[model samples]
Target: MSDKINWEYIKEFNDSIRTIWMPFGLPEIIDPSHSRFSNGVDIQPAWKIPPKIAISTTITGAMFSSRGNPNHPMTLEEISKSAREACEAGSPIVHIHVRDENGYNVLDPEKFHKVIDPLKRDFPDTVFDGCMCALDSAEWPHMESFLKEGLLEVTPINTVAVLYGDTLFAKPPYSMIEKTKICQDCGVKPQIAIYTDADVDNADRFLIKPGLLQKPYHWIILAAVPGCSPMQNPRQMVEGLMRTYNNIMDIDDTASVMVCAAGRASSYLATFAMLMGLHIRVGMEDTVWKWPHKDDKIVNNAEHFKLFKTMAGMLGREVMTPDEYRRMIGLPVRKK
Candidate 1:
């Protein structure tokens, strides 16, 4: 009830804020032994292998509405055709999302087989990975059936909850452990989909330390998704990616990190990741737009793959073949 303002308290608060804003000088040369900063130009690790970029294509994602491309693949036959084209275009890894007759994403093993069986027959060298509804109760059963049938070489286990539009994709710690155990038992690999920095810490603590996840870990750093921690801003997207990448490398330096985005920034981020010696995931599943600023819609999965390949060529990086990718990721070659 005093008329006078709290000048002393305000001064104290301003001083604390100034202290928080004080910048510290950084050394001219960062230590090469630093966990996150170990990968530098001069002190490149002798064990580092030659650069061979691996491309993973997501033919169809659950969120795409097929807006401009009415001919977008929805049925099993159409999906198979799209995936085949992608493999033919030099993308060895295909990330799949199977849909029902009504075009709804479902965890049905039979539907997945209908799409995967034909591709497996035709492209034995191609590696297949897929997305699943983490909240579905039948996730495990469907995954088990898929593994038994050899329908997938990799399966995704989201490390944290995220909002995809209005829907919340939740990943309980117990569910993640169970999924990892199933993958380990089946000799299949788990692609950790990281939506935030916390996802990395949780993966290291709940999955890695517990021995549920094994070495040569494969991670997909998801960026620019609608309601995730990373936003659509370019600065935010890159910062989030670098932070997550460093954190993952801290836990497992040999791990394979792949970059993927859910918006127009997909192409830019994928290129940045490729140049940084990381893998990339592209196609309609990640974005409908061909570029960040343009409204151009991606014609097909093959088109996107070809564009990426051209960019890789310009960067002087060779896109790995299916067999080469398999060897790099520690998967046995399907073709003799």
Candidate 2:
């Protein structure tokens, strides 16, 4: 043993650290043909984001109770109407979570079909996605049935359980695997919902290695879910964004990632992501508030979407049409 520690070993180890931009292979350079870049004013090159941010309209969801807001859409008619408004407002994809007549969350395939079928038929161009949040094995069949019928084009798959205080969401690794397989078999793409950094690590280690998760992986980062890492504060939101960005950057460049928040942070973080040239999701599902600190109440998903549209406009970013979004995310382009 040496009397003094070897400083040369530490130097070599520190110098070996490097960052990889594209891990698997180089992804096609995404061009911002549809985006409106800042032209008149000189802007920093690093400040430029992709011109078009693909937005998802989450029709009816609240961080708290189903009846959290008086204007929460419960009936299929109201849900469909909200979705239509969002589509018209520039949402290429709409994410829905069906509820009962009393505004309670339920996973009934018939209810899902009733709402999704009509909107898909009417919109024709919009893609419909959903939350397959089956907490127990018994609930899996119902969700699986929805996928089998081709009612959903994309569905969310998370490696870990989402928690609210002491309550655990109960998404075992096996369940995630089963869900991923079902999506693959049914031709429904998985959205790989990630709530924390560990989830991303799991994707890199287990999910991708077995080919359980596919390329062009769509990710939804749940930044401010209660009992999850809190992102209600602006500084915390930035930190969360950096952490997510670093983790995903380490995973794959081709992966499509989006940011969303529950309650008050919803619009703020979403707007930030939009300005950063990343995808964003907004609706009553994440929050019932129209602005930060719950300054105003949101009437419906369309209202939430319109506000986001204003933000995108101010930032000089164009919202992608359904077809443009489809092409960007590796989905089939629908005939216009």
Candidate 3:
């Protein structure tokens, strides 16, 4: 079983990723503001994030709050501020969700620059992985326009998978082809996020799309979600990922994938994901700890990191620092 797992192969890949995101100098610490949807509670303090977390070819981290509310709705005003806080907290790359004046999630054409402009000015150092919500009635042309004009660094998500099977995009602003072309034209990497082992087919369809995917793509596994089926068996889950990765590698040896598990099952899935040489995304984005079960309700950010750390240690995986992350992601170094 140990030989079958390919621990050495996985470790070599882990080391390469670490070398890419080597450790770097710490980022600035700033004051945090209200989280508007925090039920009106104050935002988590700036002191909450450590000075720096991990390193690769450059030191880097996936910056986030210990108690960030996954259930919280983000506004442009709120997201703009929230994103800045993450930047100040030493996150070079920030995953974003745009919100509106009334705090509803809207994708109005006029609102794009409202968040991007000011954010670029204040936190120029941070790389923004801008997003357009699939929940909203967003289309491909709109996605195309966002990439061409928004000047966003990366798009952490895309509607390509949603486009293949759903009839929901039978209207303007939702053309599947143009959205994909814009991404290729813009050279933004798509983070393939899936709900179940079967959903890996979504990624398969992505490869067939014209010019949507080039060689050497990145993928993410999203476990145990509502619309997506549940993965209760750890053995099946891990094995599927390995096989899926092998299949992707058959297409392109440079293919990469990661996991972002949901619910209480996240901790174990996260560990398994990392043990296999994958990146991580842990925050309030996926689950709310307000549920009754102690792990079900809200657990703090440190606990998640501790879990990640423990699993990585047991598996002989070294965490990537901020500097390492920058090189891996190809972000330019900050001038001192």
Candidate 4:
């Protein structure tokens, strides 16, 4: 049998267990056991280059209870303070989510400016990445403004339409294509968020093939969230990364892959991703639990980054600097 991965089989496996995401379209249930590539020939870790980790300091989350962490930042000053701490603790890239005075998640560019301006000034080398969340066609201009104003240098493009409770948006094939154009026009790099392997295929066929999305292809793979693609364990994380690597290898082998997850699973999955020479994302946005269990206290963003840094060092994996990370993702150097 050929050692090459069968992309068609992997896509079929993703569809086999696909379930409806309530009010939104179907998102696959990722059980690696079901993937044809799961039990195949072992793929070695990519160690020629060092590892990197991004911090997603999600000030608030879907549950609305500070993700069970009372210390989670809910105001601009608190968020700003957390960002500074995270940067000092060794996080090169920060994925941010801003909140208004009322503690509600808002995509207002002015509010974003309040958070980003001081951050860019304080930590000039830190890479700032964020999401516009669910936006309608009318809100497209606001997104464009965010990019033009230098509020967000890296933006996330969720590969599929998502709906969680009241949060809903359609990221259909056409919308993804349009978003790619927007990223290209604004001179911002798109970090494609993959919930399943099919998302990777769509990105390759619709964006890469058309010359809309460029290299080095950056991706954030979400693992194991209820009502979405599940990849909360080592096996699942390996499966997800393997599928992504196989798909992107066809387009560009130098792509960057970072993994994050919900709740306690976030830490576990991220650790495994590190062992494989893949990057990781940490912070309250992904999980508040300090350990890979629910009994732990809800740690802040800095605490999260410190833990990941310690673990990476223990494993002898050198964490990349902000400039190193910027180079890996093809980001231009910012003036200090």
Give the winner by lDDT.
Answer: 1
| Local accuracy of candidate 2 as per-residue lDDT tens digits, 4-43 | 9887776787866487664332243433332134345433
Better of 2 and 4 by TM-score: 2
Better of 3 and 4 by TM-score: 4
Candidate 1 structure quality by residue, lDDT tens digits, 1-336: 675988778777764555444223245344444434434545535444346888889988887755635646777778888988987876888988877788867777778878888888888788888875544665767767777666788888888877865888778998888888877688777889887788899898899998778778888887776766655667876787788899999998888888884576778888888778888888887667777877777888888888988988888788888878777767777648
Pitting candidate 2 against candidate 4, the one with the higher lDDT is 2
User: Model 4 off-target regions past 4 Å?
Assistant: 1-64, 162-169, 232-234
Residue by residue across 1-336, what tens digits does model 3's lDDT show?
656797877877764555544333224133255433346565665342222223101011111222344424354555555555555554445555554565544555566677667767877665566555434344545666667774665664432232321333221223333444566577655555555544455445544344465544666655544443354567655675566556555655655565664554555656566655666665445555423235464343334444555556666655555445545544445564
Runs with alpha carbons beyond 4 Å of true place in candidate 3: 1-73, 101-104, 109-112, 133-141, 156-177, 205-212, 233-240, 243-247, 290-293, 296-336
Inter-residue clash pairs, candidate 2: 61-284, 61-285
Residue pair clashes in candidate 1: none
**Models ranked on lDDT:** 1, 2, 4, 3
List model 4 lDDT by residue over 1-336, tens digit each. 676988777777764647755432224344323343456534454356464544344444433455467888888788888877877775787777778777777777777788778878878887888877545766677877777766777888878654532555447788788777778677788998876667777787788888888888898876565444555566765676677667766767778887774554677777777776778877777566666655675557777777888888888777787777777788877665
Ranking by TM-score: 1, 2, 4, 3
| lDDT scores of the candidates, listed in order | 0.78, 0.75, 0.50, 0.70
Top model by TM-score, which number?
1
